[model samples]
Target chain A: MSAAAAAAGLVLLAAVGACAGVVVGAAYVAFMNALRVPARLAALTYTRHMTRIYEAAMAAGAFLAAVWLVFPYTLRLAPAAAGFVGAAMGVYVGMLASALAETIGVIPVVARRTGLGTWVTRLIWFVVLGKITGSLIYWLYPPLVP
Target chain B: MPTVYLKPRDSLIVAPGEDITLGMLAEFAAEDHELERTLRGQPFLPGLTEGHGAISVSSLDLVRAIRRQRQDLDLRIVGPAHTVVKPRVRPNPVMAGIWTAAVTLLLFFGSLMAIMFFHADVDMPLVHRGVYQLVTGEAAPRPLVLQIPYSIGVGVGVLLFFNSLSRRKPSSDPSPLDVQMHIYDQDAQDYLVSQSAAAHRADQARQK
Candidate 1:
């Protein structure tokens, strides 16, 4: 692809990833509330989710560095590499805020109630949110899982 | 689902007749009289008013809600954690990133500076002149000021290090209410209280 075309494509991809991250995050919150998990535990799960994103970032860089050594010339694409880093951070922040907001609005209310069936349902929703975030990261970064 | 949350901590217990003001759930318990005699001077029967419903709540959601209640909450924990661990007067992350970039850049800068200072090949292409023009908005190819790149890298590294460090801090004990509930396991606590109470009971029985 032409350099300009590549830049445009990457930019559009970043924007889409960021938008999708927000949507996925919001949907998970709605789903969590419908299940009624306690607010405090929900918040901890959310914080862990954020931590996972940062971990992914550190890992991605290490992987990329390894790949660059293998592929050689690819390392010279420094600007594009930096841009990808920025995009990941941007997407992470977007999704994280949306997810937390959902938790803030609903988790506290859920904490007040009682029931085992409801608790089980909430657990499923927590996993769903985590999966959504993970999928989004995969789509954007494409983990090098050799 | 109702969202009231019990802050799960190390300390605190609630029995049916424990609350004098009936704050957590004694207020909700139907039969107060049946439990009154057993609850007297129970020392500390403080159980969560928020209750067990939030049992399914993920740990993150709980923190977010508590966090919102007090910004100080995060600052108390992560901020302090970072501060305490920070080396007494070393280069921070932001400085480090800049330094790495700067040092790399300086090497290149020194080479070019040597060229300018001594290897001033007058016959060389006006490329350097073009660089000058571009940089100064005149007609020049200014020597790639290698120092600039190093400084920029150093600046960026330091910025990143500090940003991450800030997040690593110990956030607030927003709910100073937390330490009391979580610091001890419930059974150990119950044993302690019962041991003290048992001594009192034995003393009373002896008087009889």
Candidate 2:
């Protein structure tokens, strides 16, 4: 891509990234709430923790935004980049999904017998699986994805 | 008299010998320290002054301390090594944070789909050609390939989700309870106040 084209593409990508940020941020918040045990922690502490998580999630998103903003539009865009992005996001998504199931779903179902510790372990594994799957998908077929 | 939370990653700012306190932390916060843009397992939040209560972050210290904590995350080859991903499990805090990101990604996807589907018949090529000529005076036929990279950019968002898991290295490291101080930012404070008000209202209902 020419410099001018590259610059224009960056501006467009930046706008997209800024717009996508809202979604990524909200998902992080929901995931965090799911991870916590309700009716235990005080509201202030909970908010504090949530704010911390929000900041962290956004910080991570900045990198994503940069990647998007500077995405090489050259037809030579590598397929591996797909896996790289997929693995990062997939792990993140899987982590949130697992947290929702355990904290909200399983916690209510079997909160008594299974310890929080056990739930957390399973959740981590779930996210790891997501990263692996995304990476595999990107490596195998980075172009024209589902 | 006070509790302070110290992470191994905190770089002490006091010259060789000073104390750290809430007031000093506030001053230091205003001058130098701002909230971290992202989350890392190593405690970069509210670092203690090496010698004083001041919160100034010397570049060397922040750099050195955080690196020290991350070193434990390296993978081992032969020796009994803790996996780079630590604690071997998900913490509630981490889980809640991650789910929010996923949901956010989903929402963005929905929006993207809605945009494209809403305009299915629109030839992005024609649009691109028109803009390309207007902007650069180039008569290129395939200026529409510009959208390809942006599409791929979605993967970057996806990658962030995966890295969140790896953000904190698992360790036998205990919570930095040895130090306990809370810094209030406007956003955090506002959230706390709103939640507190909600709790108070709920409590009144329960009492009634």
Candidate 3:
């Protein structure tokens, strides 16, 4: 492949990845909304189901990596490998986004229900600070896993 | 076919090969005032029975229904028992199927969109590029050897961090996701219990 063609391909991949990320983030929000009723109806079961999905995703990712290592280069497909990785990463990212959304969503309701306005604000800020700290840690450490 | 000894009262024998329902038990113990009243009041809830040296409800559906009503009733079964009751919630199959489909759809689209976004934006070539450069002397377009290891390492790291497949986690190490899920489940249950308790209290107050 020519240098110019390679550069163009790289740019296209980057653009695709960015667009995908936004869509994934949006889907995550939609998922949380969808989950709310089921969760309220059967919290334990719903939570168990979510955990199972996460575990399954993680296992699929590991299995994919194993397959990649065992299989010959001739049989390898970049798109397939990338898709599996992305899906696994998507599940993990979607979960984190959902948790963040839940935290933000629940605080106000909790505060109102309990009338602990000051406590809620303090708790929210504490969580926000913790998230900020985690982001900084991610920048420094760079996730070993996607 | 276990003979459920309604404590301090006579034992009501369940007919063999026939599943004992709350209605059947209530009918059997129609003569006993305390036992009959309790059974009639919550006729759907399963009676708690002792089996395999442990006390457990014979029917989970009954337990689920009974839990909502804050009734002080000691319904225990005694004697040698052969029944092994599994803790299960018998949900409406149609509703369960619908919810399952809904959840599956949500997860599929949610993961797909999120994956596309993250893969395209942050975790694309850049993440690989950095890892490859760190491991190998070459930059930008790193060798296949370096890239492969890094990519595989990403999967391994995720497994290790999540600790999902393993029954035992390394030392006290538990996945943050698992911890969060536990907390969420506990909070929901606590909330439900509190709501039920409050409703029970209100009902009692109204009766008074």
Candidate 4:
């Protein structure tokens, strides 16, 4: 590909990514609204304005995160602090994944198709354990990652 | 006199042409078998004479009806004072299928795009390389061990967070989605009950 063409392609992908980020952010806010998170947290008068602020903040934060990602940086943290951060990030990502899965009704479809019936819970636990093992191995033994 | 304990529901959906008995309205328990049978069998609404839609029935009305029927029995009412009776309308299978498919597709694509965009924005590969170097004291183009585990962890974490497999929830606490749906259902029922009550008032005013 020519330099100009490659540049154009990159620009297009970035544009698409930006749009996707906006859509995802909006959807997240909507999901939170549907769950009445804000209402539960705040008084009725504050909730309406709070949601608007949240939307704007999320969009700005996404853009900022993207910009920051271009730089190569490393931070040193205490092992305990690192563990805490990792666990927190894991929780956020996990909830997002769960929401996506639940919305799509993935488990029910999979169970029905495989006819796993009563065994599905056990299978889920196995997957969870496998994930924990894999993550432990990755963090503890970094040489294997390369 | 036999004392009966009655717990009324907030809302109920009844099929067309089906009789709304006292059993259908509230759950009641009595020490005496004969009284229990009578209470359960007592008719509330003979059938859907008005055809279909939401109808609000008050517990005060129910208690009065029970008193008239079984003068010898003592009644104890608990919970909501009103119940909304809605007609059970079966949705078209094709329409239901289409709706489900649309939602599933939207959610699936949206989630995928979100993950992809976030990874791209963060320059994840570069971060992975940095992390790899930091951990192993060597630079690598891609960290397959970390990437592979992380990818799997996302899926597993989601499952664990939801604490659900199929229809059954592993934990007693309800998921956020479940709570949201419940709130939505309650809102709908409340709206229907209010509408029905308004209509009843209008009819009463017109009659007067």
Pick by DockQ: which candidate is best?
4
Query: What tens digits encode model 2's per-residue C-alpha lDDT throughout A1-146?
Result: 69999999999999998788768767755546555322112231335456556556656755554454456223233443433443443333333433333333332222213323223333333333333433333323424222
- Which of the two candidates, 1 or 4, achieves a greater lDDT against the reference? 4
Question: Cα lDDT of all candidates, in order?
Answer: 0.33, 0.37, 0.42, 0.61
Q: Give per-residue lDDT, candidate 2, residue A9.
A: 96
- Candidate 1 on A1-146: residue-level lDDT in tens? 69999999999999997797568656654564443322322243346456455445545654554454455332233333433433343333323333343334332222222111122222322323333333233223323111
Error of 2 at B123 (Å): 22
In model 3, state the lDDT of residue B85: 27
Model 4: runs farther than 4 Å from truth? A1-92, A96-146, B1-3, B48-51, B67-73, B120-126, B139-145, B165-176, B194-208
- Residues A1-146, candidate 4, lDDT per residue (tens digit)? 69999999999999999898779777867876664444332332335557667666656755655655686344543333333434544544555645555565555544334433333333444444434444444434546333
Q: Taking candidate 3, what TM-score does its chain B reach relative to the real chain B? A: 0.40
Which portions of model 2 show Cα errors greater than 4 Å? A1-77, A105-108, A111-146, B1-208
TM-scores, one per candidate = 0.20, 0.23, 0.31, 0.53
- Alpha carbon deviation, residue A22, candidate 2 (Å): 7.5
Q: Of 2 and 3, which scores higher on lDDT? A: 3
TM-score of predicted model 3?
0.31
Off by over 4 Å in 3: A1-146, B1-88, B91-113, B130-135, B142-146, B167-181, B204-208
RMSD of each: 23.1, 22.3, 20.1, 12.7
* Model 4 Cα lDDT, one tens digit per residue, B1-208: 8788888889888877789998889988889877777888899886664447678898877899898877887888888878988777666678556655554444445544555455556665566556555445556576555455555555555554545544654354554444444555577678877787788789989999
Residue B178 in candidate 2 has what lDDT? 8
Query: After superposing candidate 1, which stretches have Cα over 4 Å from the reference?
Result: A1-88, A91-104, A114-134, A137-146, B1-13, B17-208
TM for candidate 4 is: 0.53
**Winner of 3 and 4 under TM-score:** 4
